[model samples]
Target: MTDTPGWASPGTAPSNEEREPGASGPTEPADRPGHTPPAPQPGAQPPGPGVKWSKEQPPPGQWSAPTGAPSPQQTPPPPPPGPGWTGQPPGGYGGGYGGPPAGYGGYGAPGGPGAWGGGWGGPPPAAKPGVIPLRPLGVGEILDGAVSTMRTHWRTVLGISLTVALLTEISLVLLQGFVLNDALAQVRVGNRAANPDEVFRALPDMMIGAGIIAVVTTIAVVIATALLTTITSRAVLGRTVSLGEAWRDARPQLPRLFGLILLLGLIVFGVMAGGALPGILVMAVGGDVVAGAGLLVLGLLAASVVTTWLVIRFCLSTPALMLERQSVVKALSRSAKLVRGSWWRTFGIMLLTGLIVRIVQVLIAIPFAVIGAAVSGDGITDLLGTGGGHTGWAYLIIQGIGALIGSALTLPISAGVTVLLYIDQRIRREALDLELARAAGVQASGAGAPGPVPGS
Candidate 1:
């Protein structure tokens, strides 16, 4: 067999038989006469490459051509090139047929990290400045996160809130029954001849009851806040921690949490006491008229300013304490630090959230109040003691129930905002956005690798 210049040997089937070796020899071209038979134009198989044809077939009209090749066909005239074309003639196109079109790498075109890095191929967009790069959180988003947490760990949020609510109601009821009832009954019966003596005698019981309620309620609140905070943090981070797990994480911080509550109560009490002190002194000096008028103006102003400052400073301390696992003092310091430059903004957000929550609480309370009044066999007027029909204790009880309902509904929203505020501060201070994104199960580049070894 004749060998083709580039064809494989005939031992195995050639990639292209048209380029295979001929039967005669390796030296001569396959087209040489007497080496290989000419392929049939109609139905005959063409001889493989390297096989010499008996006679080379001439082109249809190519005798004048040097190698008897076919002459180019002349057909319909071509259209003139458009604006972007460049070639030998307007009709002859070249150069633009292959590769990416012009302006491919420009800003608007599809290339690396196109606007927000959201196009076909590239790394993700850089985070925006000032804004926390967390998943977008609206009221609905926050509510959804809370609901998801509840759904996953219903026993935790519900169990804790319900338990606290029940205990609170029972304690309040018991206070109304045993403690307040005895004191009020004595007052009603005029047992002590002198009002001052009765007041002094009853003060200890009142103070003891108040202290018990405060401590118990504060403990409940601290537990609730910690559980809710940890659960919410896990939820916000898209992690699935159980209520038991959250509670366990929170239990260790109970003392600190209670300290935070105590600190808040003290701040509130101090402000209120300071505001009231001037009135007390004025009364002691000038009696009722001047004292009342002076206290009305000065007390309110002082209270407002102090209350605003306290709220701004301590608004997020509980969540900060819980999440950061800090002592009460540390949590207060952390809160002060976070709120340092943004006190007004933080206050405004808190005020807005409070106003909205208060409105919701009012709405929820109204229906419950109405229901409680109806259940107590008192119309609205009777319930208010304005119809000359005093439902008395019944009215107070109904009102308390209404307050309870309102508190229940407001609790979650208030707790949610507090938790969110802590997260917002972290995101601002630390690069917590990246850590949160990672926690939310977003697979970041090089994220799986261990962090740098110490001292390395």
Candidate 2:
């Protein structure tokens, strides 16, 4: 095989066989017939005159070197010129015969570490400027980003979560301690009555109280989610935002965000109601009872499926609304667009997150609840014997405290996951990581930034 400039083959002596036509080196080996080796240098010193010549001499060309020249063991001259070669280094001018092409040392080019766009190894590691790397995220990565956001920006994240949790828990405690207590007392008294009307009449008061509590809690969650979404977005840019700053950024979109959430709830409720309507009407008209019951069951099942699908489809509406400053309708559309082909993946991630949140909430709340029940009532005996029928001030307060703490800790995780999931979806579909990289001011090639977004 022929040796090329700067890329000589291992263990092979340099040969003059393929040298350029007018090159100075001899084309044939000295052993070849009629091949004459170069004569001794004219200036070379002869052997000492007094020295006697040995009768036995080796072959003339064997193991020979010119008098003043370097042997193969010493530093070698530059490789001989070949076709299109200037005898320069292997990867310079005309590179080695099979070397990488020009511009191969670039970021994602063939010859560099990112050869074949990472086909030789793996794709270049994505840029990570903050809580998450700028690329499509795995489920674990999404969860970690949420936890990391809370860790990196604890002040803002905890502030929002704690404030919302406190307000919601306090309202619940007061309602349960005062109004709900009276309502429950009346219900218990009416339970002694044989009259069904009396028992039914006492139920609305408790239901109304529970409904008010739910509304308060929902509002609190909405506010927290809005603020936390903004904070997560900034965290992705490697920027810290104060609670007040997050509030200001989120304030303008609050009304629309509330509307978006309300609309989604209504959509699910409407679908469920519509599904049950046909069966309700059938029973109301005194049709075949068995058939009516079956239809009701089927309708309800269908409604459940539809509701779940819609929920996942619009799960990203919150982030879209807050970050894009979009109207309620537009945000829903955006979520639908992002979630179009990723329904199952989105559902799985959301379902897993929900399970994690629920588990954490239960784990944190259970101990406090046990303590509250034991302290408020006549201890564990009263709770276990009466099936937890008693509700007292101590129980409510203790339980509320547990709820407050649990909410404070879990709120950021849930909110962060949602926002990061939205961003991940966008990165997959819209190449959003490039924009994020630019917005974060990271120095990477081909990175871009969206135009100034409102509330940013």
Candidate 3:
């Protein structure tokens, strides 16, 4: 019972006079540019010459009686469909009820179906549940977040790093005092003897023992770094994870993380090696001259510059490798890529983090050092069993404590930033906010039913 307008009705076509308001209508077919007038339908009424009609005319079902306008009860053409209309065929627009647009069967609509059925462009993706919105973190915010994470999870972060560091330091202490010192003592004693060849004989044994210790320390450092990275990341995100969980997550990344660390170490060593050469040459030349000093300084400066460049280039790769589950080389390459256009910003963040951590370390160490010094009769000598001098066990113990304290305070911050940087990069590169929302137990759009965070 609905009215459909005719193609030739006045409502559809403009009147002839109105079409050519101030000019004559086209007389020749060629005169009209691209427009073609519709041909008359078979048996349809043709316009009489010189006849004209006004613009106003009611649509179908709206005819007026002999001499007046139509009744007001006639409905105007339904206003052009609003913006929400998808322009589907009849019965496709909200099941003909004219409520919301078609296909909207979700909650709160009239009783067409269950509340949650059919996609209604469901609630604008709920703020990723449980994930603290990653507000653009400034240096201060980063520092504060790190501090807070450490304060909250110090037991785990500090405990793990402390245990590892302690084991490392103990091993180092023992190797240096017992193994290396005994070997040196043997060499010294041999030198005192008549046989000069004994020194050479002792050297190989010393070298082998040193090599074993070095390999062990290297392995320990690799393991420790992986653990630290995992712990730091979890802490920074304010997520609780067990030590075993962290270790397991970190284990796979050990090789690449260690490689990155080794790469950094080599860069620093290379710089120092390069710098040492000129200094050594100057010393060999016995130069008190200004040019010799200048050459030595220049070499040192060049080495420092190279070292700084290397540091900045690879600064974020370790965490990137760990968190991204990338190969060492790939992580390094990706990190270099990320840093290509933002080296200075990366450097500044690193420098700021380093400066703050170092200051804290110094503050923590100073009191211990002072206490150790004050307690010993002759400046912490008796404390170490080296009578009345600073060369004894006491100094070692105090230094060890200082190192431990510093590590405890600074380790989390350094680890946290590195991991956060990896996350930040991922967020920037990928729309990782969606992933994070899912991780935080939020129902991300485009994902199916709201579910608990995976792996939780």
lDDT by residue (1-456, candidate 1, tens digit) is 423322222332212233324333222254544768445698766444443443453333222322122235423324434322222332222212221344333222244343221233433433322122363334444444454556665666676676666667666756665556555443433234537545545544554566566656555555566668877777665555665787789889887776777787787667756776666566556566454546745785788698779768876778878877778888888888888887876776667667976797678767766776776655665444344333445655766676666655555555666677677666556656678766666643432222321211
Q: What lDDT is obtained when candidate 3 is compared to the true structure?
A: 0.57
Candidate 2 minimal-lDDT segment of 10 residues: 447-456
In model 1, residue pairs whose N, Cα or C atoms come closer than 3 Å (at least 3 residues apart or on different chains), thus clashing, are 2-22, 2-25, 3-26, 18-49, 30-51, 30-52, 36-52
RMSD of each predicted structure = 16.7, 11.8, 14.3
Query: What TM-score, over all chains together, does every model reach?
Result: 0.59, 0.65, 0.56
Model 3, range 363-409, lDDT digits (tens) per residue?
A: 88777766766764457433333342123355456756886767666
> Which candidate, 1 or 3, would have the higher TM-score against the true structure?
1
**Alpha-carbon deviation at 296 in model 2, angstroms:** 5.5
Candidate 2, 1-456: lDDT as tens digits:
233433333323323344444433223344556868667788985333222324453333332222233445544444434322222343342232333445443223344453333333323466788888787778988999999999999988898899989988998888887777655655554234335444334444665686577668656766777899988998888888998899889989978977876887688768877887776677669786656656766887899899899988988988899988889999999999999999998999888988998799889988998998788754653234333244667877888888999989988888898899899899878889888888988854423332222211
Residue 140 lDDT (model 1)? 43
Per-model lDDT: 0.57, 0.71, 0.57
- Model 3 TM-score, 2 decimals: 0.56
Error of 2 at 344 (Å): 0.8
